[model samples]
Target chain A: MEMTGLFFYLVSVLIAGGIYAVLCLALNVQWGMGGLFNAGIAGFFAVGAYASAIVTTAASDKHLGGFGLPIPLGLAAAMIVAGVTGWVVAKICVRLKSDYLAMASVGIAEILRLVIVNESWLTNGSLGISGVPRPFADLVQGRSADLVYLAVVWFCVLLVYILCQRLYVSPWGRTLRAIRDNEDSARAAGKDVDWFRLQTFVIGCALMGLAGGLSAHYFKFLSPSATEPLLVTFLVWVMLMAGGSGNNRGAIVGALAIWFIWSATEIFTSRLPPEWITRSSYIRMLLVGLLLQFVLQKFRSGLMPEKSPKIRSD
Target chain B: MIDFINLYLVPGLAIGSVYALGAVGISMIFGILRFAHFAHGDLMTIGGYGVLTAVWFIPVNPLLLLPFGIALAIVSALLVDQFFYKPLRKLPTIYTVIASFGVALIFRSVAQLFWSSGNQVFTSGVRMPMVLFDTFRISELHMQVIILTVIIAIALHFFLTRSKLGRAMRAVSDEPELAAVAGLDTERVVRWTWVIGASLAATAGVFAGMDTSMHPNLGWNLLLAMFAAAVLGGIGKPMGAIAGGFIIGIAEETVTYTWFSDEAFISPSYKSAVAFFIMVALLLFRPQGLFKGRLL
Candidate 1:
């Protein structure tokens, strides 16, 4: 490929990486800090994307909700919707231990996908909602659009990074980690374990929803298929686990690094001669799974192990 | 009434049998080993494809050739345990869950790489429907599924209760530390659990594939619902898997009735929703399930 094409591809990869980075951070807060296992990240993502899509896009005769709202408002609404969904699920499931929570989350994700696909009055069902307005679209056209979006995404990533780092050291964050370590002791110390867990779960889902909205506007379209279990949900878990969950910086770097490997590998494998694509793609997936196993066995704790939770001011 | 029987009840029973088979595996692994065993579904998928591969070469009827699939499934289960779960056996059971997720992905990819993502059937000829209760109709394949399910259920019950190894297995599950102190080879019992569980899972998957169509996602799609059945029946209780499976299956069929008869919120696509909803409700109200299975 030409140098310009290579450069553009790299930029695009970074853009995708930015979206994943936001997702990893959201996961870090839930799993890394609170010890909550949410296997349905993609459901929240799909919800956010469609929620934002409906609010901002031109009203369609076929489906509901096209108020042509502002981009920020759409994003905020996505957060609320995802947060509420997470809260409801947490109230029902967080009482159960880890494995049950994981199963319940997966169920919710599947249900959300079914709703998006079957409930045609709202989501356009399969064909998907399009013509989503990109923020600052008229100002930057051509390749510059991607560059600008990347910067915007990076800006959001940075903002989340600073906020999370602050939260990580704060007393509230310390309490969350303590609760994760031993709920009984934390409870003995008068910490409302369940309530804290529920709050953190909701906040984490809201972040995921924000990331989804960012992804939707950047793509200028929304589709039900994007909420695949393999593509978004498990992929984010792999990123957070591989990158080092507890460390905020680790989550960002891991997202970009894994996204590059995942997308680049896809491009490379698909371009391989026809005789190879069918076989090679699956082989790649196997290798990725094996890579995760190898990482778990070797790194054990992960690339950037969780920083010891020192109870102090940032 | 006959139409309803043919459409809902018979299909529900068939579907429940598959869920029961899969649930037996889930409950056994969860109850005894104390891990979620996330890859159990993929193992089922592997079994179906394993049978398909074996039958393809051996030229045997899929119904009669199930033993070959069970054998392959048992080997895969042992390998999965040795490679993934064995290393982290000492660690928290939660870690096995993460590893199982990876294994699930690996098994799925491997199936796709080798088999391709095609919906395949065991044999081409359609089974003619037979009279069941005067007006109700059942196909040869459907009858075979039910008959085989009953046979397996009976065999499993007998083995768990009467056989020496089966009793040892139960003893270990009840109290591993005490059982080990009492001279039970915990390792042998654990191995047997996976063997029986994997065999049952593979058998279910192979037949489910025959009943419907074999695809890469067949087992994965069924994973959550089967877990629901297992939990509903009680995690460690094998007999519970049967009752849970039928309940989940019937509920799944019943959920779509409103949509079929009148415009309603629950559509056919939301059939999977029924199992999850019931599962959640059960957990909330009765964590031990209808049978006296432990919450864990």
Candidate 2:
């Protein structure tokens, strides 16, 4: 591959990695910090992406959107929609135990996807919506669009990371940890467990939505199929589990590593002999499964544990 | 209305019987282990594949293959328990759940690689088609399903109530630690539980494959439906799972007939969602499930 081509691939991988990193961080907040095993993160992500796509894109001649708002405002709309959806799901699910919650979330995710697929009037259905505008397209111009978009995405990633870090060390973080470790104990200590969980879930879902919006904008298209359970949801879970669930830095690293492996495998395997490459697609799935098994067995806690601050003894 | 009941209701019952069998297995595992074994559905898929593979090798009667398929499914279940579920027993329940997800993924991938992802039709030449007057027709296959469901339910009831080992299994499910302290071999019971559960799931898978199409995702897709049944009937209650499965299956079929113009367009994809909707509704009003009794 040429240098520019390689750079584009790298940028693509980084973009995918960044989006997933955001997803993982959001999941970590819900699952690791709040002890909410949210199997429906993809639903919120889809909602955000679709919401933003509809808002910023030219209003369809037949359907909603084409308001053509700026990217920032679109992102905000995505967050708001995702947050509200999260709050609704959390309210219904928070009353249930873990297993029921997982089942409910999975159901919700499937339902959301179904709505996206079937609601042709709103989301353009299976045909999907395209021609989404990228940030600063006019300024960057031409082939530089990719690089400019990459820079913009990374900037947003850094901002989210910093924000997450700040939240992780705050008093709110301590309360979340306490709740995660022992909800009953936290409740006994005058903590409103339900409210705390709801807040955390909403925040995490908002981040997830924003990531989805960013992804849609980067791809310049939005499709219901793009938000399928296996790809958008299960892949994120795999990334988070492999990276160390609670640690944001680990999440980012894991996302990057997995994306690199996935992309390279696609490239390398396709370049191999016809017979081998023909079979590589199956092999690739097996590899992913094996890698997940390996990670689960060898490094259940992931590559990096979240860093805790030093305690000062009085 | 009478014709509709005869046509859809009867067939729905047969389909529901298969769901019941599958759900019983799933409920047993969940009640005892306290985790959603996401791979249970895939185990059924594997069983279906096993039956398909067995039929290809030995040109046995379809009826004969059913038992063989069940046996193969039992072995697969045992293997999964040994390698995947057993190791994670000491870890948190979440780890075991996650491991099961991995196991399911691996099984599906391996199945896809070996058998190919294309759907396979499993047929038993014993096609004694029962025609109950043109529109209100019932097939021998449907009869077989109902008979099998009844036999299994009765057998399970007897085993749990009468047999020492069955009682021990119940004891373990009720309270593992207490059962262990009370001189019951919990590990042995758990092993038997997997054996029985997997066997039931396999039986369902084989029968289901015969009734419909056997695909790699057949079991996995049916999982949520099984879950709906299990949860509705009260998780871990074998009889409840049976009832829940039938209710869900019939409801889904009926709902499709009532709501949609083309039954084909209704799609099985929505079946899981329908099941979940039912479950959520149940949970909202009655968290303990319909047949409130001893779950495990």
Candidate 3:
């Protein structure tokens, strides 16, 4: 029984790790490829999560959802909604330098939090939406259900990885790199820098929305707490930075490794004496923060550094 | 009118003063360091908790123990810069910004570890408002906050214009290469920037705590408003940041005031959004900000 419990715990970690893998890939597109600093990953993630939850949940008076749409459609809607939000934000903030953009995005995320809390008619205020349906729930039962979700999550991660890898070597990707590495030169070369940035930001946010939707379905519940910046935004950033920002493979590796550390630390923290239990979580957080610093300082290029594709001069 | 002035206006100015203090630091750091210090809000948190810790030991008014908070905040800022930021100085500014994000988490978690996540106040019971002219009512704290801010503003003006270090600081902020070429001590300016910024942030944190209750997120929650002030005043212009802070503070307070009808014009919950909107609008139309500080 203990062995089986450990197996199930590992499965759950993989599922969350897969979701973070997707999020890291999305962020890589913006920050790594396009050099856009999007600090409001949690905001877009919440938009997708709530959008999917509101769409797929069975008819209920508690929130503004009665559509009970198919889970796939809900996911699609999540991406689209989050993409639209990204577009709006990008239109306003894409021009700002890195730090200014970061502050603006943080503000946008805070406003979104306020909307989620105060607009009870739509989001059920702080109560959050429950009974969010999982994909293939009817076909699977008990423990198998989690396994199927794990498979689904990894499949999404694989799909996103392939897409990112393909984009990395493409001419469009080269243009984005040109803009990111040297914006004035890119503009001098007649490339529309702002438009490309907007597109990259939208695509990245859409992927984040997809990740958020997957988590909502996996947990079978959606709430504001699950979408906090520390978990959604900061954690994914750490994963991407640790994994190697420009490499898709590194994103997946970083996600799984960091997710493991994040989860396993909890096991030890939970075993502490009763008095220390409450403070353990904070200690864990401090460790994670320190880990980020170590990774940044020691492993500047991350575990899997990006290898740019060579073009023939002939 | 009396109700409006007493209820909304005074509170707005008081909070605005806090925002100004924090924004001044943010603006200076952004100007001199060339990166948005994401951990700034947490510095304020450290300040509040610093004062609270002193209060616990001395059992005195939190205001009397304000210097302790300032010292604590200054130490944290300098330490973070030394360890995290200094290492990344040669790298891109984005690296520093990202490091600051991690620093923010570290600071917040430390606060949680030292002081439980739950809310705690310096003084448990509320003080009665001071009534003036039988019609006007104001908290003594509010009066003190406003007066203190005014005094700090004047002192800051002199420090900027009169003192050699202050002028050197401004020179570095405006043109770092030029300042360096002029044989100015950049490292000394950087140290002074942290001292002034961290000290003001501590004062703001304590004042904010005194106004409300001290919590782990006391500064984090007010962070954007302070940013709005910094940006509105102009990114690197300290005086402009001060004016921007008061403007945002007053607007945030008065917007919710029910002037036209029996209900609030805007919901009180959306008061935070007011600063955000102002910031977005300014960023869109006037990216140089009101004071034309720095184009970036």
Best by DockQ: 3
Please give the range of 10 consecutive residues that has the lowest summed lDDT in model 3 chain A: A223-232
Give the alpha carbon lDDT tens digit for every residue of B85-146 in model 3: 99999987998999998998999999999999999999988699999989979999999999
Q: Tens digit of lDDT per residue, candidate 3, span A1-314?
A: 99999999999989988999999999999998998888889998888889999899999999897489999999999999999988888888887887877888888888888998999888888888899999999998999799999999999998898899898999899999999889999999999999999999999999999998998999887777765575468888899999998888988889888999889888988888999988988888888899889888999789999888997789
Q: Score candidate 1 by DockQ.
A: 0.75
Give the Å error, residue B216, model 3: 1.0
Compute DockQ for each candidate against the true complex: 0.75, 0.49, 0.89
Better of 1 and 3 by TM-score: 3
Question: Which residue pairs show backbone clashes in model 3?
Answer: B233-B240
Q: How big is the positional error of residue A61 in model 2, measured in Å on the Cα after superposition?
A: 3.6
RMSD of 1: 1.9
Q: After TM-score superposition, what is the CA distance of residue B168 in candidate 3 from its true location, in Å?
A: 0.6
Off by over 4 Å in 1: A312-314, B258-265
Q: What is the C-alpha RMSD of each candidate to the true structure, in Å?
A: 1.9, 2.8, 1.1
lDDT of each: 0.85, 0.80, 0.91
lDDT of 1 by residue, B72-180 (tens): 7899899989887888889767778888888889889988888888888887777779986678788877788888899989999999999999888777777778889
| Rank order (by TM-score, best first) | 3, 1, 2
Among all windows of ten consecutive residues in candidate 1 chain A, which has the lowest summed lDDT? A225-234
